[model samples]
Target: MEDLRIKHVSLELSENQESHRTQGFSSAKLLVVRRGAPFRVSLQLQGRAFNPQTDGLVVRVLLGKLYVTMPVTFSQSGSPSSWRAYISPEGLDPQRLSVFLQAPASAPVGAFRLLLYVLTQSSRRGYKAGRFVLLCNPWCPEDSVFIPFEDQRQEYVQSDSGLLYMGTAMNIVSRPWSFDQYEPEVLEACLSLLQVSPPHMKNSRRDYLQRSNPVYISRVVSAMINSEDDRGVLKGRWSGDFQQGMHPSTWSGSGDILVQWARSGFSPVKYGQCWVFAAVMCTVMRVLGIPCRVVTNFNSAHDTNGNLVIEEFYSETGKKLHHSTDSIWNFHVWVECWMSRADLGAGMEGWQVLDPTPQERSKGVFCCGPAPVRAIRDRRIDLPFDVPFVFAEVNAAVQTVIVRQGQALSFSTDSQRVGVLICTKAVGFPRPQNLTADYKHNKSPNSTLRSRCSSVSEDVSPRTDASHGVSVSLTLDKAPVAGEPVLFAVTVTNTEAVAKVMKEHLDAQAKEYDSSPFDSFWEAHSLIKLAPLEVKALHHQIDPALCEGVAGECLVNLAVVLEDVRTQERVLAFEEFNITSPQLSIQIAGGDSLTPHTKHAAAISFFNPFSVPVSGELTITGAGLIQGKVKYSMSALRPGGRVQQQITFRPNMLGAKMLQASLALSNNTIIRGFKMVSVNDA
Candidate 1:
């Protein structure tokens, strides 16, 4: 009898999932393949031919203490949710053999160990079959997270760079983000993210078993993205002050945040808002092979008390008062992950909204959703996983009222305001692709919400007063640029035939971009007389001095209220606008083409648009182009002066990639720019 020994084992990662849908992560030194799909393994033996009749072979897959052992089957049948394997029919040499291993479509994702046991008549021998990572498989029809389109899978799961739509819907600002899934420490950070989850730390067995379901995994990830639940990845702050930690707006990529979190002993990264949380979650989800996209809902509603309605109130001077717990963000961001919702039935499968912003709690945890978008569109709030809360985010009616010392003078229910222009980065393009139609049923996009306010205590419905014949409107002459005076006009019209004398009050306030307005920085009052059916436009300007001293991204809330001298009736109108920060112009050399492993010249320039001297740090980062980040600190730039710096550009990968530069000013203001270039194989 000869002692059979194994000499070499190879997991053919390149032939299986490497070129399937994503980047070069599949072709790592260790095997990283998607579950529900079969991966090939070749075993080279030094001894005799394997006898399938009398001898036995068992393959075991393990994660921590939980593992499954499945024998190599000769027959072609088994359950899709069960582990199975077989000897390849091709290349059946006596000593060398090829084997195919398949895990259940719903396999727990993460690093896994494989062991092969050979059983003889008298004894058994086991061999370590090498290590590999298992991710969710969207290409496999049997996978619960299976997405149908190849283009979608490429954009959602493979593309490391993306655009997060921010600002108002009408004036959209697409923020560039590097998901950086393939970065050195990013994948490890993702795995670490799961390992540090509450469930995994509590009961490892139950957590490993539940990871197979995307529903459960998404919920856990959602809770873990924010620090309120456990020692999550990010600490949320809606306040404008970021002196204690990094400002949310300054972070342009997820790798820096994730790596810092992982290196800091799983401490939550400070100062993340909705978009930051959503973008980071998108990175984690895509790394785990879950198709995901960052979605923006402009005029997004955050309903408190869960009544399916957001209440707001305005003062006689059109000042939005903080009277209610409910609020409507100028824009809200969340991730829509693609997966099959087996728990909710058939048609519910598709893009499910998973918010990691930690605004509302589900089942006592600060996890917003994995709520089916279909269920939300149908207004089926009776479903599980905070469907009602999501339903209100998109379809909730906004009831705004004007209060004059606690009395509701007027109110309007603008159903079309909430969830206006839901969108994400377009597939294979850099522009925005509107997904608003998917969230709203038979709703017109042109409809506008005219009223604004906080919450009033009185129970009131929208009512039109016949005696109130004055129409008021506020408009910005142009988009307010940083360091410049804000110019705007207020138009007042007497809709009735009779002449009227009115007292006009205009208030301007600086606020955090993600939350409600605070105190007014500037206010003006005047008496106006309007002739019958005549309209008058009053021009106004807000000096730059008023908007200074505010930290982080700021939006100006300009509101006007008119009081009729004849009947004491008031008409209100307001406009919310953000100052467009000056961009750090990033110019790559040679126009469009860059050769891999070669040095090229690039330039980052910024013209100080501020009246005061500016001092800050500039950071340049590219995923595959360079290692971490190239940063520089500026001494100071006088007003209206231009500063240009040269950067040595080098790319290490072939394909299209983005080079981004961001300038974080001493005032906590951040401005960024990016340029896409193609890398030639030469």
Candidate 2:
């Protein structure tokens, strides 16, 4: 008898992808399927029939040196972490065979090489079948990453477009993000992330074996997102100089960064800050079928020494001094991934904090967490994988010090200053959902924090208050918008029954979201004399052009420092004023209804708000609506002038898509807008 030769194999891509919930992602085109799901495969034999008696059909799945072999048969039960295949009764033939292969829900996830062997009593012949990518299954309950809610699965695991909260807690800015996982370049890049990781490169078998656990996979991904230790996906640039690469704020989506990294042979893409790292990490996690969301923690702290305290020094003149290595960010963005932590026990599951911003080292690398939020809330400092680091980020006390010359004249700790508000994009909405309660035991950390982190100190001293005969308050008249002057007031009240005289210094500086205030661009110093119990509201307006920086978030760090001329007692009041860019208007040529694969036209318009002429590039990116990005260089538009760009987008895939536009100006001001378009199937 001739050897059993195989002619061809069919992966049934359409049927498998639809059932596996992987069809929306571009990975499905390469036969990507979720584990725990049964997918049909057809085989054509050229020589002889597959005889179950003398000839055995064996299926092999390989990942690097690690491989799993399963003897193909009917009704065979095995381990959940093992592969399985059964003869399909739907369609069967001697020359042609249709079999269903089910990857164990707990199987290692990544690209797998499929192979088939036909063994006879006389000989054994093997055929190289194709390869398919495997992802974690949020649909299967047996899977540790299983998410029960349908809407959550859709938002976290499937939705390609999202919002990343930025700016300060007082003025929350909802910036749109295109995860773009459906883009072909993104899918390949995300998988390539696993391939280029240090662990995968050094020990492929061990890395492949570790993929069975979501925790392991998350930790690996977090470490691979920044290029500090490993030549990872992004290179962090915190010094505010992005000349080597694109500005971190210029990135509107992960697709661009991922494609650039993969196409450059895994070269680290230049310039990623907290949001960029967190956003890209979110994209990778979601593409791999893990539920993830980008979170912004306002008043976040970076305790370099790990004492759970961020000491900030201010000159007696009210200028922030770089005295301590510790710092408090206006806002820090990170991601929270959903998974079951079997290793940490039952209650220690759900959303785990994962920071990919190349912060301090964790376990000898620069990736933070898989830190259980539950553990952080319960003050479980000894938990694994940098729980203390993440806990400090949201709970660290702010130690404010007023330095005179080289001496620290006064110091005070505000337990509730750091981690004032923690939030993420609300499910099925663009608004922010406050997660502050989840991270903090109470809004006021006075007693709660002191009880927990023996590290978090009490008020060592106090700023000038009623006891000192004066109180100061800095208030913004209205939310600051880009192109419009920032109007705010400093309210100084003499609470004492006697006349009081004080020296007031007001400072306004430009700052990045994750950085401290730079140089003061605007300042005012004046001496004021107040009668008994007199209240004074001093109004000030800052020119829009004066505060805008070449590279930084459109925010103004406005501070008012007061010193009693008689007593030398001082008080400080500050406000982080974020400049909200005017939203671009997205208008569909003919309402919102759309059809797949059909060309459609839309117009994006922006009204110049500045007193000076502005020029920039408008980039439009939509995953299902368009491929990659289309950029148009806009000429200078006079102040208060309106400019609109007409562009055509063809729906390549059907589903909901966000049509997003970002206008990056020469002045470093970024204006953005988006429209959600629902496309029907063809």
Q: Against the hidden true structure, what lDDT does model 1 obtain?
A: 0.81
Q: What is the lDDT of residue 264 in candidate 2?
A: 93
**What RMSD, rounded to one decimal, does every model reach?**
4.7, 4.9
lDDT by residue (tens digit), candidate 2, 45-97: 88777666676788998887788888888665667666889886556688998
Give each model's whole-structure lDDT: 0.81, 0.82
Please tell me which predicted candidate would have the highest lDDT against the true structure: 2
Tens-digit lDDT track for model 1 on 258-282? 9899999999999899999999999
What local lDDT does model 1 show for residue 164? Answer: 82
Which 10 consecutive positions of candidate 2 have the poorest summed lDDT?
448-457
Superposed model 2: Cα runs more than 4 Å off: 1-4, 25-29, 46-55, 76-78, 120-123, 444-467, 548-552
TM-scores, all candidates, are 0.91, 0.93
Please give the distance, in angstroms, between residue 221's alpha carbon in candidate 1 and its true position after superposition.
0.7
